[model samples]
Target chain A: MRGVVTLHADGLSKDFGERSALRDVSFEVSEGERVAVIGPNGAGKTTLLSLLAGLQRATAGTVSRPPEEIGWVPQQAALYRRLSIRENLRLFARLERVADPDAAVDRALELTGLADRAKDELSTLSGGNQQRVNIAIGLLADPPVLLLDEPSSSLDPRQRAVLWDFIDGLAAGGTAVIFATHEIDEAQRHADRILVLGDGELIFTGTAAELHAAGGDDDLVVAFVRVLEAQGH
Target chain B: MRWLLLKDLQILRRSPLLIGLLVVYPVVISLLIGFALSRGPDKPKIAFVNEVPELQQTINVGGDQIDIASYSDRLFERVDPVPAATREEALQMVEDGEVLGALIIPEDAGRKLQTAVALGGSAEKPTVEVLYDASGPLQGQLVESLVDSTLAEANVAIGERITEVSAGYLNILLDGGSFSLLGQDFDILGLAEAERILGRQAAQLPAGSTERAELERIRRFAELAVENLDFSDEILSSISNPIDVKETPVGSSGGTTLESFAVSASVVFSLMFVCVLLAAGMLALEREEHAYGRLVRGLVSRGKLLAEKVLLAALCALPVGLVMLVVVALLADLDWGRAPLWTVGVLATGLAFGALGVAIGAVAREVRAASLLAFGLSLPIAFLALVPAGTVADPLYEVIRVVSAAFPFKPSLLAMDAALNETGDMWPSVLHLLGLTAAYGVLARVALRRFG
Candidate 1:
């Protein structure tokens, strides 16, 4: 909130017909901040990201960000199945109206380490490679902020480590990154600050150390399990 | 934009069903139309009954003179000639389907002509009856005309012979009154004298002037002759007009061959409009897949993404349209003289339709709903192309005409036809297609705002 805020959301809320998905949710991520948004399946972590990404309009809230300032990688890999890896990158570059699409695509492919398989169709790529392509698409416009949802969900441990390292490098380069994941260990490893949601409301906001010290009795996951057990889960 | 276009092109290349439909449809249509237009004859059996030997002789002579055998060979593969024992038998043959038709010469026909000639007057014409199955009008008419032509020639010949004999008898009566030949001629003269005496006795009773009666009779006879001649000429003209409008292929550019090819080409290209629906569905799928959310987060505006999808669909539609055009050209033997014009027209039409499809698809949330709506809207538009310009006289067709004029494919068809046949105004159709393209573009843009 102090540094030049990359994203600022105040009193953000969403309603679908009769059901409210989120209610007056507000948060801000400063420049180069690595934030992890964690919640149970229906706790509206996805909705928050969607609102932040400008995919859905808030019922009442204010979101301030420059156009094309955020790079989003969806939970599911959004790679075009019919297009080759390079072609998919090129399509995003062209759509973004990048002046030199070929160079932009080449750079993105190199960043994602998918340069070697540029000519291969997306369908032929493994789930991990496809995820990399999706990430590459988000990186094509070279936006200052990256928003990823469950980016490591489909990858193996090795692939996940590679992705975490990539995100760490991006953060080091002063690109703010916010990702949503259920994996507490991965979040603790990469995230500078962690935000937790429970039943459509933000329950916790602090660093991993603070969260662990507060729990005291066990780790973050163990604490969550004990809390669920107390509720007769 | 180029990348989006290239990606779509790659997808189109892999679709085998699309390729086959694009290439084969026009060729099949062309072959069907060609087969229908080819001249082929029908074979029908004919039976005849000739009670008078002279009548049969006249028919044989007339048939030989007209080259009936050669004509029949060219017209029909089989010409069965059955001789009936009696007039009733000939008629029965026709009823029983033993033959298509039968011609009967009356038994007293020759005797009646001879008596009328002896009396120094026009002959009582022998009546020839033609029996035919009413179920087959064309065949019945053909057989009837053939027989009638033969009878007409015989009548003309008999008329000339009777006129000569009457003239000779009159001269003999006028110059040589008392001779051996007089007995033969005077025997008929006695009956004429008796008939004259009876006419004079009847005329004594006052009714009207003889001159008036004679004038009225002459007028009636003249009217009857004119009516008969006109009727005969009308029938003959109708017969001649059969198959008169032979559609010769105008250097492979005109006639039913090209017309059918154009129709198939139009249909094939029209289907390319479905690509718009596919593009629309792709957009919907993106929303379902949460890709839109990702793009939004990536700072891609809704409008830009929608624009990109529309552009992609239009780009895809171009080659699909071209593939259809190429297929038609190769398979249907489409004349290449106007290929450039057709290609341009088809491309414009394809873009308009593609845009329209995207618009429709955008409104529906799922592929099933989008497909149903797209297909429903396009079916009526496609149907409009089937109605021939000359035959579209109904009020509903006029409405369809107005609506279809607003679609690029219809105008493209109109332009193509005009280019190939030079039958309609091409400029108006071109303008119409342009207007449709603009309208579709506007609609697509509007749809993006409403449903994007």
Candidate 2:
């Protein structure tokens, strides 16, 4: 999305006991880049995002980025139901060692369009509002790399649009974003480049037009299915 | 009505654990405790003060009198005789938290036995004084039983001595002392003739018991006791119960029964509410919500995580506890034996219970498990952790007490109990609470490492 890459990964692999979650996946994200890690149910999308966010250590290979430069939203929204939105933001900012937590919290609340509901507890908000609060917490200290694993999995179509538009603004503002999604069309439409993983391996990584041409189809979704079939899925 | 009932069922299914906590827990806990108490008496460690050790002698009792040093030595090991040279020193030991309950043996106790045996039933009855620490209806019973048995054997020895005195004069009485008031041998004398004979003997009988029937009567009275020879019913009553058993619990309060109960309820309930709400409810919720993971990702250290939990728990729990104490103090003439020290104990209770809750959360990783584990542990603690310290002075209880002793509130509550009862050494309780709080904090830290 912008010049000069700020994050780099090479041949990242992870295994949980005997089961391999990710293997030989390499990627690079420049400032303002939006990279979508798209895969099916056990394609290691969440695991790859976790490794990128430094929420986990890779079993082999490496991913390089400043630890403080990354923010993560787990599959589950990491917001305490009892604490107010403002309190949650302030807590995260304080914990993240932000230079001025008060200012950071206020700014995050305003940016997320949750300034009106900042004093309200997360439990009292609508599902979409709660997701916004979760995103605000991740963006509170202004980390450059935002890793969200299936943030819209629970959102409806309208809520998903709201979330993607907000995420789009972050990428436009020069924050590199990596989000995992099972919806192929959404990923094809939103991301600058798609990383398609099949059976824990990165089978393909390219733009929707490049993927369509490679699979010999005009429809990107059909092309994605063709690529997975070719990868022995 | 049907819809309302259906709604209740839905709510119940939604939070089945909450319902179980409110209902099943109490019933199960009551059953466990009832079974344990019914099994047998939990013996206490009674501290006997050997104030006059030289004078405490083993009386020769029964046919096999090869002899033990004293009945004290033959007692259950729980009853330990602490060597206290003086009665004052023994009581001071109790106040200083050195010993539990104690029995004082006088210097002339052994001499009284010797005199009883030599004079046969005509000697002075030796007395024993018992001293008990703070509160223990149970330990008091144990001490009473011990003394009862010891004195019982002594009574047997005195009875044998009296029988020997009776036999010494039985040779003369064997002739049946046939009496005739009118200068004739009347074996079947009427009341008039018997009265006349008694009057004759009374005039001629030297100071006491010269005749055979008179000697027999003396022996009967001597079997009970001999020194105070006034044979009226009132005199016999005094002799029968010689040991007054004046159990003066060092600092007994001069308050209503309700007031005393309020203090105990204050300490125990304060401990329970703070610990359960913080550790089990809040901490487990944090873990379940993945906030702990989120916090760590935000560069929060492990120590800060525990500190935050403790701080939050205290913030929530201490005010309620302090308010409860203030209300009680205002309602009654609550004797804060050592006022500043009592306040310190209350504070320690809050801190320690907060740690206890954290430790529970560390062990139990989910909301249900945390609640069950914390409450399950706390209920037993409230019951077994006797506040007066010596309330359950059984040596056996002491062994398992190590578990409850590790809780800060246990020691803090004990100090409060002791101080209120007017029997305590403040440093011991405070130091114990501090040690346990640190231990609990360390345990929580270790537990969170694996649990997280």
Candidate 3:
């Protein structure tokens, strides 16, 4: 994977009504980098991903990236379920203004191993296949940055491994992947850098080894607890 | 854009429930509306308590009398005239709901008219009182309307009687020179029976009496009046209508009874499109599935997404509109002409509903919400349109009409009315529908873009 800078977020913050969801959150994702936003429920993991995905604008900071170049995969698979997998891919490709929509969809189907089920209604697919189709639609644009929210939340262990492998392949091809997930172990294994947020504040940002070193804990779970404890969460 | 649009079509084709509704409802509901309005209500109930039996006597013209009962008989033809023993009995029947209303004629009505005519037709015309039961307000209003119309006809009848009396007086004075006796029939003389008695009056007068002198004076005056009688075209117009309306109504009476109903029925059918079901649920479905966020971040702009959805819905609505047009025309002998005008109206109507659907999609945020809104929006437009076209011009309907103009269905319905009526000027209505459709489109776009 190429080591080219793709996305830069500085001092990102978000608030909903009187409650703050994120504060002083900043991160840079280079080409081929996989960043995981990990936090307990209501700790602003989804909020941060939403902000980076451009689904929601930050309350107090700037995100610098090429316009219309980010591919976002929502937790529930945001494509139309009534539409066939191929149709969904084709629609997303068209939206991205891909030079050749047919080719883009075909490549996405191949990458996700969804070529056989491309013509099937998304609702008819198993959860694993549907999730793969979701990732495939996100890949249709060949975007430099991809944001996913809980892509494996509904997947079994084997399905989750299969999805992670496909996502890893995309990152290998110079794609910057940022995802939000509740699974701290998965983040430790797959993420190049883990962002641990507690009570709307980013308390730790580093690889699993570095996080363990900083927290004086060997296990990634203990390291996560230590990080949150240090932040007084 | 193509892919996005095709997906909607694909969904429509694949969803059995949706396909069934779109294909079947247009025909079934159109027929239902057509049937419901085609026969409309039964004959309005009326009780006639005609106490003036003496009014049945004939009116005398130059000693020839004509009966007044003949003219009044036509008034009762439009109602289901109920039978009752007396005026009080008729009133009770109305209260009991046996009849909608009653017309109570006074016993002295004939005597008054006769005595008034005897004194040169100068007395005021006797009036008939109307009594009605007010229960079932709508039905009550209907009965009242029927009674009012009947009364108008009766007034015309009275006017004819007065005209006859004056013409009879002229007959007496002219002594049948050119004046025709209104009541007496003569085979060879054309009402010249009055002139045959002229010499008898001369012989009956006493020699050198004052009565003879007065008879001579009247005869001389009558002679001069008959000699100077005007038969020009202007004066002859009284034989026909003195103020002939010349009709020129908005379309050929909107065809026979069935045809007129079609205009309103088709309108109602067209209105049932997306605003009835899909518009209410569209955005709600999107939010429920959480697809809105993905689509916004992906290919299409928010504006484009909304526009595309509206376009799809409008496309779906077109066939339904066409079905309404065809079904109504078939049943009612309705004139569905000015193809260009109808085409534009149908398209705009479809788009407007589509826009409404987009708005619904945004606000409902749930399937049930969509259904409720569709039901909510549909009934009002449909109700306003459900009435017969003839009643639309009634002052009672003015409120509905004004409110209906801002809606897509009403304008399209009215445009079709102009076309069916052959009133020749339908563009104003067409423009109204298009303008409304555009407004709905703009509103839906704004809403979905902001909220979706």
Candidate 4:
């Protein structure tokens, strides 16, 4: 069961010059709810996440969550490669004005299960570990809403499982989770509510069973393709 | 802000190569500038062609003989003057680039000089022709300067000799020989004889006659006028020391001390390499790592982000600048006037350059490109800032002056120079620096927006 709404976007629209990236996208997320923004390439999933994370501004409409109350983890590691994981966390914690940066860094380390590798520089870490540090940076302030853009794009199966488990714990703790992903299986398995976007327009929004029923197909990838085709993408 | 500063410092501390470069850059620049100013230019080899051996002469001035040959010999101290057998040989040597320049004394020069000296007026002055290898312009100019200076000394010696010789002859004539007055030549012996004869005639005329009184008055007047005509000492004194010269400078200090020059050079080097390059490189590094957007999303404001980077650069640069000053002080006599003002100048310089570097890094996509841009910008700015006024042609120097002043380098240098040398007003530089800092700060913020 979903709790009270923690994030709300109403009539969000974004345009890049003459081309529209997102068109009147609307969504709502309640506490502890896991939402997946699944789309084809150039389908405005990242654009929507950026708008919600306050990394970019929407041309129209609004996001109810204040930017300070949001945690944005981009596709790239984006953390300082020369700095250690603890240093990176502490820096972001201080930047976000956390009450206690060291405590926040420690908690982020414990949450990501990267406390043992806290002293290792980002460059020396494996891709998965580096990505954990990236997520750790986003989790420093312990915000109410977390937005991840293709968080597991480059991870192996084992690393992907570990990242999902960590994110699952956060969502279970009432942190509203919104993620953009290309992997259909991960979205169907992990997300409680899935939003399908095709060519900058939201074509479907429901649980996996509802989407499967609507597409007249049991397979999630097949249903996703049918949804995109129906939207003329 | 502290976290932002610490992050950059921690990165720098890990990179030993970067730290080494930061320490080395300013020290090396200071030493190089110190050595360059302390020493004079190398002596250039020149060919000397004396067409007339007769002109190898000497003139007597106040009983001291000054040899014209010795003047050329004195030039050898500043240049390697090789003897060429003929004017053609000297020209060939110059064309072959065997020497920097050639000095040729024409065959008729000796005769012309003699005639001019003897006539005491209205004679064609002898000229010595110089043919320099213009291919190497700087060396050619040095050769010209060395030869010209020697010849000037020789001319002064000759002129004084001529005046002394003329005065000696005048005194001899005024004392006991025939002297000319109002275009009429008169022998003193004849004048004395006439005076004696007239006195006897006047005495034989009458004791109280009008003719006797008139002849006596005329003889007395002539005697007094002859005594006054022998004032040669006054004329000699007037001839020797004509037109006294006293130099007064328009600015505060007599001139910029060598120490002050080195201080300015060291500070400018630190600004370009330590402040500007480091700031640009760090910002570009973030862009390269793709962390710029993350920071933008997390930080309070983009303006604060840029300000931290600028402040980081300046704080890092301060110690490096001081190290450069210490090295300069060791190498030269450094006078750091008023500690507070010097510190302000250095800090302002760092801020101005740091802002500029941030602006550059914001536009550059990566660290290598930012470094290249910094290099391209710094060389010309350093050259323009350090190049002394009047070193080039008037029009080109004016252009450089205006262009350099428009940027922060010259003003930073001027401020530091004023503090070190205690010359010129530093307030103008301070104002200019503040204005530049604000302008570059705005530029960096705007570029970062596009970058983000």
**Model 1 compared with the native: what TM-score?**
0.56
Tens digits of per-residue lDDT for model 4, B66-118: 46565566567776677999988887887665666777777666666665655
lDDT of 2 by residue, B218-259 (tens): 444433332232233342222332222345554343221334
- Which candidate number has the best lDDT? 4
Q: Please tell me which model should have the higher DockQ, number 2 or number 3.
A: 3
What are the DockQ scores of the candidates, in order? 0.22, 0.39, 0.40, 0.45
> What Cα-based lDDT does every candidate model obtain?
0.63, 0.68, 0.68, 0.75
DockQ of 4: 0.45
The predicted structure with the larger lDDT, 1 or 2, is: 2
Decide which is better by DockQ, 1 or 3: 3
TM-score of each: 0.56, 0.69, 0.65, 0.68
The model with the greatest DockQ is: 4
Backbone clash tally (model 1): 1
lDDT of 2 by residue, A1-233 (tens): 35788889899999988999999888888889888888778989988887877667789988787556788888788888889999988888888888999999989888778898889988898888888888888887788889888889889899999999999999999998899998888888789988999989999988878889877899888898899899997
Residue B177 of model 1: what lDDT? 35
Q: Which residue runs does candidate 4 get wrong by more than 4 Å?
A: B1-248, B387-398
Worst 10 residues of 3 chain B by lDDT: B241-250
What value does the lDDT take at residue B330 in candidate 2? 84
Distance from true position, residue A155, model 4, in Å? 0.8
Candidate 3 per-residue lDDT, tens place, A150-195, comes to 8899999999999899889888888999999889888988899888
Model 3 achieves a DockQ score of 0.40
Interface root-mean-square deviation (Å) of every model: 3.1, 1.6, 2.1, 1.5
